[model samples]
Target: MNEPGDIEVERELVRAMNDSAGNEPVPAYDPQQLAASGRRHRRQVWALAASVAAVAALGAGLAALLSGGGPSHTVPVTAGPAAPRPVGSPPASAPDAARGWATMRTVLLAAERYENPATRGTVQLGQVAALFTDQAAFTRVWGSGGLGATCGAVADGALTMDHSGVLLYRGSVQLPDHAAFTFDDRTGRISGVSCGSGQLPGGLGHQTIAAVFGSQVSGGKAGDGLVGPQVSSLDCSPADRPLTNWYGDIATGGGLAVPPTWQWQVTLNGDQADGPLSAVVDHTGLMTQATCPTSSP
Candidate 1:
């Protein structure tokens, strides 16, 4: 069963393929095709990752799905998931998120994302000092190497509370990996920053992910790939959830090979116990997944 708007993905893919400069009619991709064509190849790569748990990195590339005779237009859109999608709630009765939480989240994410070698010890650090509760601690170990319990974006998307009443703020990177902060709303400071999982492979699309895992969702309440890795501890799903686009970034060289495309998906890496299983729908109705490293090397 396809998600509500999965047909839209297929329609969009067909439209994109039709508009390509020089190419034949492109058919909406089938997850099974991507799954079957690369069975042995995936085994080899996964075997390598399994042997070296630390080597579980994401592969980045433009999805050039082949058509009948051979691969054609660069169709790279994430697949759509059915109902029972990731709910931004844990087991507890999460309280209504503070209005400022969303605003501060945007600010903190940008500030952390902007941190780099050049910005080290610069005014930018002091500029966002008010965001963190323990400026010294946050600054001491701010850039990369991990921040929250899960190294990858185990708990991303909307905000929620845990059983202990701790705010599960977005604990991850703009890219490269995931993690979270146990924010103290009272003090307007992060009480906990954890990154037990290590950096994950970055910039992979749904085709790559579905090829890698076969899009079976071996274990989940829905088994339809929705309600995937926990999104939050809030207990209910939000009316409007944000979707992560998997467009090939020029900076990362994921688009130079072929024409760039767009994809949007919910977070499927919130349950730290379930490995780095990202779920997204590609243009041809394929779910994407990236195994974020469990621990740093």
Candidate 2:
């Protein structure tokens, strides 16, 4: 019940934790919290990709007022079935590994026709490029200033070294819908990118994402310990190995987080679909989820 733009992402994360108190290191962050956390995480990744479009437009305006409230009236509701098809596999090749998975499914259908939030652009990258290998290691793996900055395609290919022989060239990027990019296909680099839950931002209208994390999502709480809980389900298959980020070049700037950070980890499945189910992302893209039996059964 937050989504008013997540009350401005909890008052801009409480004014970026009161301007990064004491430590005095994490300061210099004011590009409007880097453009309101990348437009409220792309409107929480299109509200997790049309989660029933605002309750199907309030159930089609209550079935057109129950067909004009006539014909012996009847409006019972129960729905909650259809939600299967979520296994995993595919997208894990390495003969040379510089971009496989059929060019990451045509760069996730051309970055889903360029940020198609249902349609027409802005950002959404839905399938997150099914987890990359091509498209220049998915713009260095999910290009990020923090959120939006993707580019795609660049690895010329032709370098073989796996078995930790290490040459690395895979690809992935699709934050359009909030998160994805799995790099390395031959120096086009970026080893992993996952981001979870179709795209999470249910803090809804969170007062315009808490006026752009002006305080770091209100000094810890919503999933505490770095953000966990809330999210329900999410998956991005393919991962035999390679998804590192030792500080892939470091330089987050306004998008927060310094000292070269950009990590990965995903497996959400939030809405309690069984299993301990837990997902976590950090290094500053900030993602969370947890039921914690120890995280995923």
Candidate 3:
């Protein structure tokens, strides 16, 4: 009986050793622990590979969206391979007179109103500074007083005048504000423009007014209905002083309410008044020599 049991034990030991050599040792618990470990490692590697592939696909989709599938944003202009078309040029009548004038007017108004009426107080002054030669003239106009006086102008051919008006005041009291537009055949632009009464040195004297305020005005409208009395002839006194500096104790009543409206005498080098005389203007309107008589107060 002892010999039989001992033989059985030897057989059992041989089986265990053979099983370990063929299929690896059984782990702490499961019978198929070794096989399960190999399978789990393979599964983990495959899972990582799949995740990398998914990320690559996502990156490619984003790239396609951003590039629009091409290198440029502008639409490509091309003709079919069978029949190529020719590019045509613009018409000669595309000057767009109305649009051009409207744009110019807008720019002028912006500069006059908000684009730094003077160099000292505003930032936009630099933009409009090129419009005037004398910088000191601009500063003087804004610094002299508050919003006591104002001027405006407008012109249209087939349309009526707009954005052109005035409000005049002298020391707290208001004056008769006058604003008008007329055609100037000579310059092909609107001519007469009246803003308001200003302590501007020359008043509305011929030379001072024409030289100072001419550029802002335009020729006339399409119809001849707006024509006024012919200018006849113009004359200007050499030593004439603007009425603003005069009238200390004139025979008139009230304590100098508004500046006198003098006839604007036109004096130009040669006969440039018939055409365009290069001038200097500020936000306060035309810039004139501010001497004793014409001192632009």
The clash count of every prediction, one per candidate, is 28, 69, 17
Arranged by lDDT, best first: 1, 2, 3
Best by lDDT: 1
- Tens-digit lDDT track of model 3 for 1-297: 469989999999999999889897555766598789989999999999999999997788689878777343567888666643222211113243233233223223332234223322432445433322245533432222211112322211011122233222222232344332222222222223334543322222222233222221222122122112342112221335211100010011112334332221222211122322222222233332221223211
Model 1: lDDT equals: 0.36
Clashes of 3: 17
Q: Give TM per candidate.
A: 0.25, 0.16, 0.18
Per-residue lDDT of model 2, residues 1-297, tens digit only: 788899999999999888788557655879988999999999989987788688887787788788885234478989988665322222244543334432432343333234323322433354443344455545555564212222332221111111111111112221222234444444333344443334332221222111212122123233233443455532221243211110011111222444223222111111122332233344443444323334333
Q: Give stretches of model 2 more than 4 Å off.
A: 1-131, 135-137, 144-291, 294-297
Off by over 4 Å in 1: 1-104, 111-113, 116-123, 141-177, 198-297
